[model samples]
Target: MTNSKVGHRIEELTTPAFLLDLVKVKSNCQGMLETCKAMGVSLRAQTKTHKTVEGAVLQTGGSRKGIVTSTIDECEFYADHGFDDILYGYPLIAHHMPRISALTRRLEKFHVMVDSKLAVETLIASQPPTGKTWSVFLKVDCGNNRAGVWWEDEESIILAHQLGSYSSLITFRGLYVHCGNSYYAKTDVEVEKVRDENIERLLNFVDRVKERGVTCETIGIGSTPSCKKPSDNMKKLDELHPGNYVFLDVQQSTLGSCIVDEIACRVATRIIGHYPKRNQMLIDCGFTGLTKQGEGMLVTGYGIIRDNPNLKICNMTQEIGYIEPLKGKLDFEKYPVGSLLFIFPWHSCATAAMHSVYYVIEEDKVVAEWKPTRGW
Candidate 1:
């Protein structure tokens, strides 16, 4: 963002807009890429967070492929734009296998998740071309209790080895685990422990499988909170996928992942009205635009106001926000009506996904703008 361009864009645009600092965005992107380089693993970033092609490109380093999507529509959109090697990363519902088979036809390598006999049977019945390999990974439950097989369950253990039988069409990729508990870590020290423990358990699972000559071809592990604090533990995995680092949100900040300066995206709103008597103010930005996420009883608001830390967006209605001024604080002389303010969301990915386009800023100025790809 430049000084002149900031003025130009401010004049050209209306309030309640999405602002993106490319400088900060680039830095955030580079930090995660560097972490992957140091870990000696392939980075197949999860795109469910950003849900944008521009956001995806910034994190791609040089390659425009080998990414993960959360939805079938997202997979089709990315593949249409020449992005191959996509892993849906979610559970394989039996009814969705037909659509999944169609996606396999569009990519060089398409990976799916399998954790049940029903899912496996449906996948076998709906197979794609023999020329392009269809790969499947068993989602391991590393004590997350999520949608995955227990690491030591006899059924899961037997299924892991049985996958080798579909040698002609479906190939066993490896064990896939999402260490969701990593987010519970309070400090960087604790976060590193979570990372190490996740790697230890998953690698132990790998060793357990290798005992039967059923070596995992791809060992995958990730969680944004886990990757935020890098560790030597990552060396055990073949690939790492972390998505939310592209836009550092307040949630990441609360988790101690990154600071406000590292935050690349924000919501720009104007002070529409003031209530000096009630010690509050109103802004045009609301849940419809800013996204109702990353805030709760503790946060107690939609987002954090960058200029005023003590001020609380305590109350929010359809088209207004009540800015609770600190006790006995009534100083709207400095903040007047129509003043543009920046807000950092609790979840960067969720907030940014709702935005239509982003104004690229540099040095506190808007210099460029980029539209984001939105939808499932």
Candidate 2:
């Protein structure tokens, strides 16, 4: 789904459009790839953040060619784009088997994550007529406590053995864990501490499972915060899957994962009204433009003004954003009506999902329009 209107200027485009700086995006992807290479781990670029084929190809860098997707639609989209090795990172549901089965036949390698016995049973029962075995990864909960079985749980060991026993229908891939808690960290020390702790826990669990005669071919560990500011302990992981590094937001900036300048995506909006007496300005962007993801200390509102860092998107209606100074009196004269402003979202992933297309910006001009896959 390519938008043929390429080389349009940012100002010429409609207001409230998502802008992706190709330079920053490529730099982020290259940095992560090099980091994983230096740490001796494979980089399974996560596509859940930037769900576009262009972004995926950039992330893979034509090497390793591994990607992690969060939805079956994403699986189909990437598979159609000739991305053969894909991991559907979410826990498996029984009803998704038909599509998963189809994908397995089409893809060179298609893997799914599972954390329960029912998921395994469902996969075995729905084994496709193609006779291709389903690749499975046991999702281990390494302190995130979001999903997956607890790392030390004895049942996890039992589940691993059970999965390994299904030699005919299933190929046990490895262990996967997301250090989501690292996003809550406020300092670099805390971020590193969480990263190291996750590594140690994942390694310990891998050892425990190995002792039980289960071979984990891969040990996946990562989140944007952990992967960007990884500790020396991360050298032991087999692969890293960090998505948001593609377009860092205020949340990552606050977590010390990246600085504000590293953020690659922003919303370009125009000031529609100005309330000089109240020191507030209304912009043609709001929750519909930038998602309300208040994840970090630096994000006190809907989003941050890129040029005026101190100006906060204090409130938002469906289509209107209110901007006001956070530290000092708002200077309405500095921002007149019809002025263009770029807003860095608090969470890039959520903000990106709101837009169907991304306006690629390079050297102060729109280079291309990237259409991301939509639907669950």
Candidate 3:
């Protein structure tokens, strides 16, 4: 379905279509690349947000390399499309060995992340594809409290030593932390504080490991909020892997990672019905189209209706959204039936994952349609 409607305006597209602003996407990708260069660190762009090959290519700045994927499917999809230096930045389990082993063999620089002794032991027990060693990254929990061994835990140091002990079977890559907690920050100052704190903790852990004589070839941390507003101290790290910056969302904007005008993705819907009696208009988008992720977080409800700040998405069903005004009445005359309305998603990643295809727009016209590779 590539370029399905190459020359049509977005208003002509079917309702509830996912739209990607090509220009904004390019700007976002280039900005991140330039940010990494200025910080003197590499950018291992994550592909979980927009999983299209075109987006990934733009992310890498046409290098076709240095990407960390969240799933084996994304890894294979990139590999199948000639992307190299891929990292399966997820916890390893015995169940994923076969596919991991294959990916390790297939790419020149494929790596996996692990946070447990079992993962290291699993890699030690299984031999890599003949001439390869199991490249592993120690996932460190630096305040995010998600995956990865805790940075302050003595067990974290022991785990690194354990991986070092088996040099023949496994190669300890480095530390990877997801600074997801940065999302909780209420202001830009708090976001930078979280970034600096996480970096300090991670570097301290690296020093402790160095005392034990374990070297971390690559050290990196990532979260859209942190990476987008990078601290000067981020230069100490070796890499930054952030995905959501490709399509800055309302959430990112609120975090000060980007302004609302920079958001590159939107759900294009239309007015399906008008109910002036109840002061509400019905849009052809619901939880399925825009997702219910940012519910109660934004005053506008599930998503921000572009160019219509007064219009609020008050409620939604599976395939319909109820819209009214923030204050008084919703003038149905201004929003006639069949008129198009674009919604900037609250969480671009969650919202993007719901759509099968993305309409690539430039100057209000659809120039291409990108089909993202789906599934875990």
* Number of the top-ranking candidate, with lDDT as the measure: 3
lDDT for each residue of candidate 1 in 89-154, tens digit (9 for 90 to 100): 888987777778788876788899887777777666765765765688888887677778887777
Sort all candidates by TM-score, best to worst.
Answer: 3, 2, 1
Q: What is the lDDT of residue 24 in candidate 3?
A: 97
Model 3 spans with C-alpha error above 4 angstroms: 1-3
Model 2 C-alpha lDDT versus the unseen true structure? 0.87
Instruction: Estimate TM-scores for all models.
Output: 0.92, 0.96, 0.98
Give candidate 2 misplaced runs (Cα > 4 Å). 1-5
Better of 1 and 3 by lDDT: 3
For model 3, give the 10-residue run with minimal summed lDDT: 1-10
TM-score of 3: 0.98
Local distance difference test, per candidate?
0.77, 0.87, 0.92
Give one digit per residue, the lDDT tens place, for model 2 in 93-200: 988888888888888889999999899888878765476789999999989989898998899889988888988888999999999989878798998888888889
Over 4 Å off in model 1, which ranges? 1-8, 297-300, 364-368
**Full ranking by lDDT:** 3, 2, 1
